[model samples]
Target: MSKLPLDPDVADVAPTDSALTPYDNQHIVTYARLLQAESEGADWREVARIVLHIDPDHEPDRAQNAYLSHLARAKWVTGQGRLLRGAGSN
Candidate 1:
């Protein structure tokens, strides 16, 4: 995968910066949409393709893997895709 084009602002993380939060709202929404598609038996690779359209230089494999891991954990606890749906509902 090609490297993402760095945003100089984002590249600099101060000790007290709030930008390091693990769950970015936009990222969360993307992950949730991907998860929902997967739950409906949609091809994850296809979802990844669509996601990469927004951030083409993103590491698609990593993003997909993270979303899958999150979905699996949520499924184990909730037995449904509600959490994934909720994440993107806003």
Candidate 2:
């Protein structure tokens, strides 16, 4: 698996008064699942679209860009997975 990009600022800030918002956590989890399901295959553009859908008002920050790049790289390495699995699979 490719190394996930980390935002230095995110770590720089103290967590005592900081916590990921529900939306943030949701995006993170969705991204992780997308990455894992595709075996690290995820397109940055598609990921960006997903991110935008999650937070339309929020601008694409540095961390977001980094993540998109990472996803693109992963997608390049591995192909996107099947939308549907075997028969009877939900």
Q: Which candidate leads in TM-score?
A: 1
Q: Where does the lowest 10-residue lDDT sum fall in candidate 2?
A: 8-17
Overall lDDT per candidate, in order of appearance: 0.42, 0.37
- The Cα error of candidate 2 at residue 72, in Å, is 12
Candidate 1, residue 2: lDDT: 33
Clashing pairs in model 1?
none
- Model 2, C-alpha of 81: deviation from truth (Å): 24
Clashes of each: 0, 0
Candidate 2 regions with alpha-carbon error over 4 angstroms: 1-28, 37-40, 51-90
Error of 2 at 53 (Å): 2.9
**lDDT of candidate 1 at residue 48, scale 0 to 100:** 48
lDDT against true structure, model 2: 0.37
- Score residue 6 of candidate 1 by CA lDDT: 24
Residue-wise lDDT of candidate 1 within 1-90, one digit each (tens)?
333232111111112222322333324444445457777887656654554332214665564654455444434323334344543342
Give the best candidate by lDDT. Answer: 1
Q: Which stretches of candidate 1 lie over 4 Å from their true place?
A: 1-23, 54-90
Q: What is the C-alpha RMSD of each candidate to the true structure, in Å?
A: 10.5, 12.8
